[model samples]
Target: MTNDPAIAFRVTALEDNQPNGREPILGGILRKKAVWVDESLCIGCTYCSCVATNTFTMEPDNGRARAFRQDGDSTEVIQEAIDTCPVNCIDWVKFEDLDDLRSQLNAKTIRPLGLPPLR
Candidate 1:
């Protein structure tokens, strides 16, 4: 392994090109589970961003990662990102529950990097 620090996750063989992160989203077009990143749990490691280049992106202000486009990348690529996450912040959620989850997240406190905490 090279010490380049650039590579996020390695796909050794062609067989490794499967979405082994979670069970296949079988069913019709309306799949219930979709990928999401919990900003509160994110460590801003950038591993997800590097792995899923088109799917995940880092918020400049907080340095935390978020899923910009749900279908930006392939399932295998996104799975790799989710798996490579050291904090396991990335996850799947129901489409109908996204609003509630967002509301809950909004109620939580977020302390971004390079900032002082309030007293």
Candidate 2:
């Protein structure tokens, strides 16, 4: 949560490409954006946690990765974690939409180990 504002801004630099027009608020935006891991799509690889220790943690029960702390690490580190996801489950998302994503996650069934259904 104590990440540098510049680094945070660098993370939001992609905000320009997004549809939302939310203006930068310096410190206000430190947690404005976040990385999301779809547990249903998660493969329990733990690469995200390994890359962004502060931001991600592995779930004990399901053995899936979760975004436990928003803005817990530098944006670069979190992005690295996203890139390491072999299943392409991790993604960048708007802060406000998190609740809905969580709701969906809550309703979803985690994909079993070994193989996932074709998209």
Candidate 3:
């Protein structure tokens, strides 16, 4: 809670001093790997969406990519999307901390697009 509306995610932890919004290249539980897109730097490249169609989709308004469903594709495929992002705006985050990150981001809550057969 600061008054700044741009900050979306927040976490209050006493013992573990881990940075609240640090984005890891490959971290988090395998079953709960979470993905997020940084709208500021995202060039609206379709690389991620094309690589992981099920996991990512382009926002109609800005054409920026967002993760509609973290589990839409396998972690391996999602990684491909992240790697393919030329601007490197996509991030892999721990699922348990996802809510904290989302809450602090300026973006709205994203609903999972649903689990489909992995592409």
Full-model lDDT for every candidate: 0.79, 0.77, 0.72
Which residue pairs come into collision in candidate 3? 7-104, 8-103, 8-104, 8-105, 9-103, 9-104, 9-105
The candidate that achieves the highest TM-score relative to the unseen native structure = 1
Candidate 1 residue-wise lDDT at 23: 32
What range of 10 consecutive residues in model 2 has the weakest lDDT sum?
18-27
Model 2 steric clash pairs: none
The runs of at least 3 residues in candidate 3 whose Cα sits more than 4 Å from the true structure, single-residue gaps closed, are 1-30, 107-119
Q: How many pairs collide in each candidate, listed in order?
A: 0, 0, 7
Error of 1 at 17 (Å): 17
Worst 10-residue lDDT window, candidate 1: 20-29
* Candidate 1 lDDT for residue 9: 64
Q: State the local distance difference test value for candidate 2.
A: 0.77
Candidate 3: tens digits of C-alpha lDDT, residues 34-92: 79887656778789989888878888765678788765776777888899999999998
TM-score of each: 0.69, 0.67, 0.59
Task: Give a tens-digit lDDT track for model 1, residues 3-114.
Answer: 8655546635575554433333333345447788999889899999898887788988788998877666667778888999998998988878778888988899998876
Order of candidate numbers by lDDT, starting with the best: 1, 2, 3
Error of 3 at 85 (Å): 0.5
